[model samples]
Target: MDSETTIREPRAADGGLDLSPVSRGRTPLLLRFTLFAIFFFPATMVIEPLGASGTVPTLLCLVLLLAWLASWLWGLHDPIPVRHPGRLAISLLLLASIASYAALYAGWTGGSTEMTRASADRWLLLLAASAALVLVTAEVIRTMADALQLVRALLAGAFFCCLVGVAQFVFRVNPMEWIQAAMPGFTYNGGDTPFQIRGSLMRVAGSTFHSIELGVVAAMLIPLSIWRSLTDPRGRRWFHWAQTALLVFAVTTTVSRSGILGLVVALLVFVPFLPRLVRRGLLLSAPFVVAGVFLIVPGFVGTIASALGADTSDPSIATRVNNYPRVVQLLDSHPILGSGPGNYTPPDALRILDNQYLGSLVTLGIVGLLATLAYFLLPGIAGVLAARAAVHPALRGLAGAVAAGALVAAVCSMTFDSLSFPVFALLYPALVGLAGGVWRMVRREADLRDDENAATARGAMMARAPAPTAKEVG
Candidate 1:
């Protein structure tokens, strides 16, 4: 072909690159693959059908680590930016772990020989996952529009879990039995109490390993349902009502007082700015709560009466009250570093503390406990700030809801169980992402204001300045 006839290469100035197709096509595939790895690995490893632990969870984690490593490698061409807000805090946490390990190795009394390298791996994995998510997601999806997709994904994921949880309650089955069959070594601890006013109802755990895990799932969904009701188009308003119903149904079945309290706390956090949404959301949710009462109210009353009246002579409540002093006594012995990570004895383990913050101090010491609090509270503060300053109605609602959910769960989790489960682990990091996104939105608005001011200043200076004259110049 003649040189003149040859197709000319695109130039740098003319809308240089067309990455629309590439970006759009690649994103869904990558995200789907990542989610698959995340959900599959943890599910299978712990149970079986989900994987051994869960193929999806395992790969999702590994991929995130690999992505971070790749960013380091690419730094030779262009250095990556810092995105992790809790980097300093997380670093201190890791250092504490190492220092504790060394103290135990040298002469510390509370250290355990059973504390293997695997314990270190567990903490490191969480830090790695948190750090990686902040980095990869900041690049892959930077805009508010992009972040909303993540919010939607979170809502959809929670909804699926809630649906399954409700099904478990109605059907009295694990539902994900194929995966459970593969992991025969694991035990199912679910049980329904009878001889009460309420019918026997299965506590819905869904894909999670415990009923409390289901509660965490419920708490996260409540905010999204409220957000949808407020910001969604009028035509789509009914969808939010349906979601509210689902959340109430699932939450009631879990029969967790902590979870119920969490729902109330989450709503309270957002109600000041979103009273209309709050009112509507609650109205939609009330029926499901009532339905739950109808199904289990009699049984619940009997159970409560048995405990309050001491009719059954069960020591569960009394035993927990009795153990509080013992736990306090034990805390005095290892206030700084605790008994060491993974250092719980059978007695300590069997105590059933029902308190995450106390349990953390007992197991991992003050350092871990503080880190846990910081992790939960930081996003909440950031989220509240976002809600206060949000410009778009939809984004504001979503951020506010997520923030509220985190706050509720933080309070509820502290009283029920330590944040050791995968559900809590997963939700915290996701909330961190949402908070970071909100911060970016706020920052961008500030930048825009600054730009507008600068432009006005420039125009005013030009208008006021005298025009140069030839005679004056000469």
Candidate 2:
């Protein structure tokens, strides 16, 4: 490759020409740990026995915060990329969360109580940790290669989960229970049942606390895996395609209507950005793919059909529909700053509102709601914009995948408390941070190209000058 092309290429730490600002300098240990943890998050769940209050994700966040603090104290923390619009939005959201929590604690919101106060405090801590994560991720993932590495990790994690889910479905094994049994203190909130059976087919939840959560994760991965399969070189293309199949199977096996819808939404967001041939091929193959799956597992098809049809008789759907009015009433009572995060009491037997948007409104109020929306939407918009401007094909595809994942999470939030879940909560924001980093990299490359072009033009003009040097010298 030419020097200009080499400058645009993504470089690794192993002797390649490092063009990324983040990669140019020695990466801090804490930042490296955070990056590694994020990619291997699924495996990290196995260490839940060490988590506070039996919540592994919470423990991980705490560790992240401590690492960040230690890094700061040691003067190893990189500057937060505040110039990135997505990062700026996240910082604003964190500030708003703190303010809202303070207002709730002081009874300024009119709905505050001891329960709300405690809940708000916990949420505030989580927000702080999440802000730190965003900052660290943006600082660390400064190139297309870095972003792609994270995506590959996510695919690997998703593939493993899918394999576990498949085993759970086929063999009726409860891996969570098995793990808890092996380690006495290891506990999970998922039920004792091996799988969730719906319409004569077994639903697989994998290692996540719930089936819906697994579905959401699978939905987010599908688009990204598809993009990778198409764009990756021949050596790795088949592997990514296989991963895509596994992810699709996992999503279907979850028997989650919202999950399917989320996948559809993500594909809709992703397809427009794809090459014409790939787009056409996907559109044409989708039906055959569905038909083939149905041929293999007819019972699974029934479950999907029933779920998609919005069967009012289905207990889950009925519960969600029934809970909508109560959620609205709760939101009405606390329209400003909310009662507190995770503090809204359900009016009925159902404990979960099942809708993240409504739950946020009731718990965090209008200000928090707006902030949450900005946190999610701003990064998604930034990803879409970055995809348009990205010079590298892989970077552009990765940006599109990020945007799709954000949209999928948003769609899933309509049916589940997606933002509260560990995988969704952490992964979504991290992807946004990655998107912001990619955007900055694209902008820098564009600026450099412009400067190079301008310099070349100036040199040409000087060469074309009519004997100006000889005349001036004389």
Candidate 3:
């Protein structure tokens, strides 16, 4: 059978792929669970027993990983794409973590290992959980239809987050606090309240713990949302575009310069892949979106302008500058594996290095840092390859969008301590995993098509050839 035929897919009234679960197969429970973990059990809510690393989303990810493990072990599904570069990179990253931890104990870090021991272990566990999330996502959702399902779920979660952010920034009402109040046992991790005001504008974090974090999350989602909107059937595109606009507007609510930068980066990565008409339409809409924001939020345009124009006097800028020397000095001491993860406590290390590359250099060190770079970048590179090779439009769109998200996540790290906030961390790997998976599917499609073509050629050659003569046969 041709690879384009999906047993579960059904056409929708809009003349596009129906996004309902029925169209994505009956047994994509892990995808559903992953979405549920994103929407209902946010990354902020931690159960007491599991400690700080035991946020509902994190634990749920760990659960999903275990479920995938059992299936793999029991031979319930196809074998994992073990040879994929992203998977290999993540494995290398984890191994690097183990090496770094051992190096710490070997007194290579030249510190009292006891002080950083437990913290380092916790970081290792978190890294493991992060790997689990990325791997399971890449393994489980293997088809275009299921990939669309994942996209829709992520869009919904991002949409919901944007709505909450809008309400917080504009309406002065926060529904997340209500959920927090009702769930007595669950406390928010990262004890930072994301409510701040800048020149009469409310800076809100939405489901994320910090406003800057929300900025990158919005930046990451905008591309995916745009891909969905543009690919959806004619009538439904507006709704998705509206969702994209909400994401854009939500970032403005944060009043963050990095948020603006993320938006710019996402657009730059995503826009080039669009068709001419779509690209023109997208470009033309920007002014209207800006006008809409200005009309709705009054000073939003000025607020965003002010944020973008912020100078070195801004504390975020000043602190980032100060970290350069500190990070360089630390790198001199333990350049290979540095100190183990979580050993860079704020007080002991002087201050947090918000840069992901720098912190990874200090904590995970050079070898682990290279592994970390591979883990973040390789999947997106694969997606770019897949997009170029893709025969199907859906696969092309998914690959492009996911690639944009991964690239955005990687660059966004330059601005802040990105993965420390589970929201960004969660979505980044999901994007990475989804990219890797989409690439595999595209490759499989190519392989299947080649086989079909080869068989057709053989049949045609046989048909064209004359039958053997009786004398010749004798």
| Candidate 2 lDDT over residue span 293-352, tens digit each | 687666877778777886668677788888767766777766776776667666654667
RMSD list, candidates in order: 7.7, 4.7, 4.5
lDDT order of candidates, top first: 3, 2, 1
Q: Where does candidate 3 stray beyond 4 Å?
A: 1-22, 78-82, 112-115, 188-190, 232-238, 348-350, 459-474
Instruction: Give the local distance difference test score of model 2.
Output: 0.68
- For each candidate, give its TM-score against the true structure: 0.76, 0.84, 0.88
Question: What tens digits encode model 1's per-residue C-alpha lDDT throughout 234-348?
Answer: 2356776777667766666666556667777877776655656556766787676766666653465444333335522445445556657877787788777766554554465
**For residues 352-441, what per-residue lDDT tens digits would candidate 3 score against the true structure?**
788888888888889878987887788777777777787666667677778778777788788888867777777777777777677777
Which of candidates 1 and 3 reaches a greater lDDT? 3
lDDT of each: 0.57, 0.68, 0.74
Candidate 2 Cα errors over 4 Å, as ranges: 1-54, 80-82, 109-115, 182-194, 230-236, 311-315, 347-351
Candidate 3 overall lDDT versus native: 0.74
Candidate 2 structure, TM-score to reference: 0.84
| TM-score, structure 1 vs. true | 0.76
Residue 266 lDDT (model 2): 84
